[model samples]
Target chain A: AQSVTQPDIHITVSEGASLELRCNYSYGATPYLFWYVQSPGQGLQLLLKYFSGDTLVQGIKGFEAEFKRSQSSFNLRKPSVHWSDAAEYFCAVALYGGATNKLIFGTGTLLAVQP
Target chain B: EPEVTQTPSHQVTQMGQEVILRCVPISNHLYFYWYRQILGQKVEFLVSFYNNEISEKSEIFDDQFSVERPDGSNFTLKIRSTKLEDSAMYFCASRAKNIQYFGAGTRLSVL
Candidate 1:
């Protein structure tokens, strides 16, 4: 089975500060990783996904994540944090080349940006 | 852009009653899925539908839960008997290939 772990339950970052959310996964094979953001009263939105390409993957809203196979990590990063970036972020993994599209998601990290 | 849409943004139903949550997936997408998020919990997959049949389902999708793509655009989830545990935000998703787009979700509240 595949599983994702997000160590940080809550993180507070000031505006203009850099932000990093740690994510770790347990999978037997090379897995497809994804980051999703859910704002207050909104649905989950795909931030970015890693299929098989470069380790560094860019996503919408100036967010990026690095897939490190050795560490089993796909940590999300943003150079400058904005107030609007405060939301709950989830890390997920799907089985590579599997018929089902089921995704195993982490508990999520709630981000808060201060002025 | 094309996106998945769900109806009844918030629904309040009594326990032991029947409730149906509806969704309209992206027109071109072939696979549809239902997920739910309990308060303070991660999103959990309920079921996946393809070719007018269920392709996969989680243990959470027991006999009380059922999904149907009754029409070309409408995909519905019917709960035979609702319970307080079923109260959550139900999300509908659709995918053409790898990326799955999600609907805003319908919040089901059981009383």
Candidate 2:
């Protein structure tokens, strides 16, 4: 079974400050990782995804994540966060075929940006 | 620009009553899914449907929970008997190939 672990439940970043959210997964094979954001009273929105290729993947709203296989981590980063970036973020892993292939989500990390 | 939309933004049902949540995924999407989030909990996958059959389902999707794509544009999840515990936001999602798109979600309350 593939699962995700987001170590930080809450993170506060000031406007113009860099942000990093930690995510770790447990999967037997190469994992398909994704980041999703949900604003207040909204549905989950895709940030980005990683299957293979470059270790660093860029996403919308200037978000990026690096896939580290050895550490089983896919950490999201942003050089400068805006006030509008405050939201709940989730990290998930997609199982390969025959393994159900469902996206299992993390508990989510709450981001608070101060202006 | 294409997005998944769900109907009955909020529903309040009595315990033991049946409730149906509807969704219209992106017109051309081939795969559909249902997920739920209990308050302060993770987004848990209930089931995934493709080719008119269930591709996969989690343990939380028991006999009480059922899914059907009655028409080309509609996908529905039905609960035989609603429970207080079932009171949560149920989200509908669609997938083109790899990434899934989610709907705004239906908040179901069982009193």
Candidate 3:
């Protein structure tokens, strides 16, 4: 079975500060990776995803993540974050094909942006 | 902008009672899924549906829980006898290929 681990439980950053949320996964083969953000009462919105090719994948909201195969990591990063960026972020993985293509999400990282 | 939509923002049901959560996925999406999240826990996968058949399910999706794509537009999750532990936010997700989209979610409370 595959699992995703987001080491940071909660992160607080001042507005305009650079942000990075670490994520690590344990899977046998290279899996489909994704980053999603959820507002306090809203649904999970996809920021970006990595299937193949580029190790550095760009997403919406000026956010990006790099997939390092050797390290089994897909970390989400933003050059500068705004107060509106404060929310819960999740890292997920899904299988390739026939084998139950459901996403397995990590515990999540709660981001708190201060003024 | 098309997105998944779930009904009843919040539902309060008694234990041993039956509850059905409804969802309307993105019109073009062919794959559908149901996931649950305990208040402070991770989002857990319950079942995945595609082409009118089940692709996969998790251990937490026991006999009490079932999913249906009854019509062309709707996919539903039915819990035969709800339990107290089942109180959580249930999210409906739809996917086409790798990108999976989610709805706001229905907070189910079993008392």
Best by DockQ, which number?
3
Worst 10-residue lDDT window, candidate 3 chain A: A94-103
lDDT of 2 by residue, B3-106 (tens): 99999999999999999999999999888899999998999999999889999898999999999999899999999999999999999998876888999899
TM-score of each: 0.98, 0.97, 0.98
Candidate 3 TM-score versus the reference: 0.98
- Chain A TM-scores, per candidate, are 0.97, 0.95, 0.97
Model 3 agreement with the true structure over B1-111: per-residue lDDT tens digits: 998999988999999999999999999989899999999999999999888888888899999999999889999999999999999999999988778899999999999
What are the DockQ scores of the candidates, in order? 0.72, 0.68, 0.81
Q: Best lDDT goes to which candidate?
A: 3
Quote the lDDT for A21 in model 2. 98
Candidate 1: stretches off by over 4 Å:
A96-99
Cα lDDT tens digits, model 2, A5-65, are 9999999999999999999999898778999999988989999999889999999999999
Error of 1 at B40 (Å): 0.3
CA deviation > 4 Å runs, candidate 3:
none
